[model samples]
Target: MTATLASVPVRSRSFAFILGSPRSGGNTETLARYAAEGLPPDSTSGWLNLCDLPLPAQPAGPVPSGAEKVLLDATLESTDIVVASPLHWYSVSAATKLYLDYWARWIALPDVSFRERMRGKNLWAVTAYARGDDRDTEPLTGMLRRTADYLAMEWRGALLARAHRPGDLEADPAILSRAAGFFDPRD
Candidate 1:
């Protein structure tokens, strides 16, 4: 029940991609990269693998430091935010969920208009799953839309692909076409 990616007019925009899966070089990462293919190198902020960073102590605890902070900084400056995660129990991975949990901290950071900064920015969800119930993607998409709504950001729909294993996307012509056409500016 994942929503089809809207055929909106494409315009070059800075994007910071967050890889939510813990497995390095996995299909989720590959799919996210593919979805971003239309964005030029300079327009893309590059991918940040959350699995490589330390998780915050608690949801209400202080924000993460070092690499996580750098990721946050990049996100703060980006025009769009893309969250790429593998389906775990019908939802995003622990890494992606925890990273999002930290947003509460940003919303409360004193002297920093973090939430305000996020306002008006576009939020996109990208994920891949196995041959299981693709219907599982529905709840996750709802969660993303709600999150974006709460943050006052625009919900830009999602690019969902089914890949049982790494490199499987190579055979998904529909997904490949969707990803390839994502950034092409149309009249």
Candidate 2:
């Protein structure tokens, strides 16, 4: 059964959009932008697109780059974070996963911990899949939930939609409405 979003609460929310698409104007980014539009203007929003900021593969013991640190800090400090990605093999896209994997550096450091940085933060996952079946999303949802749990963040909710082609989500009213409702600050 499709879950209802009426119970979700939003107040003084700051959002960070972890966009996973290699292309800047892809469906996932578009959907994320749409969701962010519903938030109050006072709320801070940051967009961290992996394609735009590619980190080295598994840096040897936290190769701290000022730009990456700034982006990561902004995401960690946000009150609300929306992880938006296109599905890859029924899971988060590699681009997004790579960004997430970098979190390991923070958690592994002796002085810094993900729990300390992310505690009490609200987390949301927005996934776009070509397949229409809800079952296809279970693994992705579980992965996201586990990530949130590890960071001691609140798993606010998820917004799942299907996009078979470019701009498909925009043409689908049901999916658009559901997404808007799920991410709506007033809802």
Candidate 3:
């Protein structure tokens, strides 16, 4: 994946790296963890693995709270947001997909400000597939980009890693460095 970002003037840059793989030790999670290693020292950053959260179905309230709220808040508060997931048959993992589905509910809230709040943030993605071909990830990337467009966020590209098994990314020093450098402002 290319390591680049939109040339926007970030007032207070921050990154929220999210992991949506079902396996806590999955390659997607590994890459995301390593990628966040290079975040600017002064930037606010956090990593949330969605596999650990409970996606309960509930109607929206005045102030959305809990995991969904935390994630939405982080996505809004940060200048950049990284969404990482393992491609599950040309689509994001179930957890990631479901988390995104919450956007629908959030937008329907009584005092919904979800769309307005998400405007202009940079949305990045990190995904992996056993196929070892970037082509397999195109659909996912397109979905992410379209989602960003729909939310009025910016699509800042993606890291499409190749992993045949767990810990594969850890074995490639060059890829590991590139992954981490995604967040490195110094390049």
After best superposition, candidate 2 residue 185: deviation in angstroms?
Answer: 2.7
Give the lDDT of residue 147 in candidate 1. Answer: 95
- Candidate 3 local Cα displacement, residue 47, angstroms: 1.5
lDDT of 3 by residue, 66-115 (tens): 77677777766778888899999998988888888888877776575878
Could you estimate the TM-score for every candidate?
A: 0.85, 0.85, 0.84
Deviation of model 3 at 89, angstroms: 0.8
Better of 2 and 3 by lDDT: 3
lDDT of 2 by residue, 25-107 (tens): 88877777777777776688888887777766766445456556765786767888888988889888888787778777767
User: Model 1: per-residue lDDT, tens digit, 15-109?
Assistant: 88988988887888887777777775557566788877656656334554686677778789888899998888888998888888878777787
lDDT of 1: 0.80
> How many residue pairs collide in each prediction?
0, 0, 0
Report the C-alpha displacement of residue 72, candidate 2, in angstroms: 1.9
The predictions' CA RMSDs to the true structure, in order, are 7.4, 6.9, 6.1
Model 2 reaches what TM-score against the true structure?
0.85
Which lDDT values do the candidates have, in the order given? 0.80, 0.78, 0.81
Residue-pair clash count for candidate 2 = 0
Off by over 4 Å in 1: 1-12, 40-42, 59-64, 184-187
